[model samples]
Target: MHPSAFLRLAALLALSLPAHAQEGMKQQPAASDRVKEVPSIEAVGLSGLKPGTILFTDHRDDPAKPENGLVPYLDWGRVRPAERAALAPYAGYAEPDYLQTLNGVSKRRHETLKVYVAQGRFVVPRPADSIDLASYATLGFVAKMDPVIKHKTLNPADVTPTKDPAAAFAKRPDRPWCDLGTVCIESRYDLEGKLPLGVKLANKLEDGASKKVAEFVSFQSELRTLPPAETAPLAGLTKIDAPVTGGLEQTIFWVNQILRFGKFLAVFQPMPGDPAKTVVTTYMALAIKADVLDRKQEYARVPVLKNLLPAQVLMGNSSFNTGTSISAGLPTYARNRMTAFADALAKN
Candidate 1:
């Protein structure tokens, strides 16, 4: 049976028992109380399941701590900004111009190169002076298990927080259900709610069927609805109508865009050939709309994410082939820029 379902059953069992009979037994909190604290659209209880029976635990409230009750190495605040920035550029934004120096070529050759070598490679030409806005949504996966926490053995200053950050994070730990290996899974929750967004992209890539790839690309195009909060503003922008081409390249683009504009969330790429594989890998991102340049107050409100320590389940060999998986940290320049933006916005 699905671990989530099992968890629900366990929770139900814990709840259904007589109060007097349960008095000697461990007292489980009421479901409503848990829900009020967690504030999730989805609800699940897994107290009845034996150790190791539960799959995913909801950890949205406390990313640093494990949902199943383990202490994690880091929390969301420590890692979110970096991950968002790493995922940002992949969304179909204009790549910055590269200044190349021709050591061996003459002035004439350099001029010639300029005519042919327009700034960056043209997978798609960015809209001139305008931002492309697409409707975006996100689905997060939560785990029920607690993470094993690791603290720095040495302290920079012989000081600790009067209050524990880990305890603060775990205060309201509820989220959409996930399995042991997958925690805090983020994806484009299709606005129409008809198709599985990110999973479909992974499946098409794995099948190696070009025709399906094209269809998947088309599906993404259809999924470009307006974000719930920013629909009117996004509708005013020019919509790019070109069909997204390329295999993984197109997939990466869509994923990146979602990260940037939708919710500033990052997603894990599946293995080269396995469709079922959905593990968060490297390449974090930071995406901000051009308009945010002017609206300091709105931009300042954007949250800073840091200290992203993914669960152990996210680590390990790819299910597809035992190839070396890719992981990346946010670029220094990108981090600096985002921090600057946030700082400027705050000041303004």
Candidate 2:
């Protein structure tokens, strides 16, 4: 990244520090000693939402109440024979091949990364009255990535389908990732996660434009390896994988694919005991500059760094779902880009 870009990003982030940004003369523990905050399901809010509502959050998990019993949403069993090859790249970040084969700008830089996890929930209308929420929310919408970005343009042709991630990324992207790294185009994706609707739910709605809708819902995104720092805190997240009736997975890129960025795993299921309202749990771990994670430093040499820092990663709606939008990371930055996403999912 250019030096000037970093300055702009640093300034943007300095201004973003919430009024309550943590500060204690470096009283905080070392990064390794730190813990991943996994908000409880209760704090996530389980009730009192009107049907077709999209509730979102990037709140920290309550460490004191430690959540436990979380396994991958589409653990080994959920994988099928054919999908193994196609999903290898998206789910194989832990393997040496992933880093070894990384090409273009998305290659790993060995920077200290800070991962963030967040979730969103909403209720499907009882009568299933609305646009094709599944199509809008899932994958294969590359041809229709409208209303997503403000300055950049992506060619649907560049988004070809292939199971081999190593090969795909090895090839150069025909388009630029962002405009000078400003919020102009906060983030982009390599693989889009899909949360397929079950027969019970699919039967009620009109499937949208993507013929790939069925695959999107069933396609589950996952991580092959997570830093111990991230996993240790999640060991007790018992309900982390709960209520996951269906799953999807995808990976993202930023700043001209300068970094592999991160991957996203999400699950969709009926709210326990409440068949009408559906819940979505999205988990993501991003590779962020540990320097930027420093609340006290002026660490923004990258143009788009302000889009999301270690403290508040921008995942969820904008970058993870079917397609990146024209107004991604917009309306707000700290929160997961779910507002536009919710608007798509909201039942009519």
| Highest-scoring model, TM-score | 2
Residue-by-residue lDDT tens digits, candidate 1, 1-348: 355544454344335444543333222222221112222211322222122121222223442331222211122223333322222222222322223335654232111100000000011112211212221111110111101111111121211111233212112123211212121232222121111221232233234432231111110101122223422222111111221111110111222221212122212222223323222111122222222122234212311101111111112111111111111111222222222222222232
Instruction: Report how far off residue 323 is in candidate 1 (Å).
Output: 14
Task: Candidate 1: list runs displaced more than 4 Å.
Answer: 1-123, 137-348
Stretches of candidate 2 exceeding 4 Å from the true structure: 1-39, 42-45, 48-55, 59-92, 95-109, 127-134, 137-245, 253-259, 264-266, 283-285, 291-331, 334-336
What's the TM for model 1? 0.16
At residue 151, give the lDDT of candidate 1.
Answer: 15
Taking the tens digit of each residue's C-alpha lDDT, what string does model 2 give over 239-311? 4333334444444443232123444444455556655655554443333334443532221233222222323
For the record, the alpha-carbon RMSD of candidate 1 to the native fold, in angstroms, is: 26.7
lDDT, residue 52, candidate 2:
46
TM-score for candidate 2: 0.40
Q: State the weakest 10-residue window (summed lDDT) of model 1.
A: 112-121
RMSD of each: 26.7, 16.6
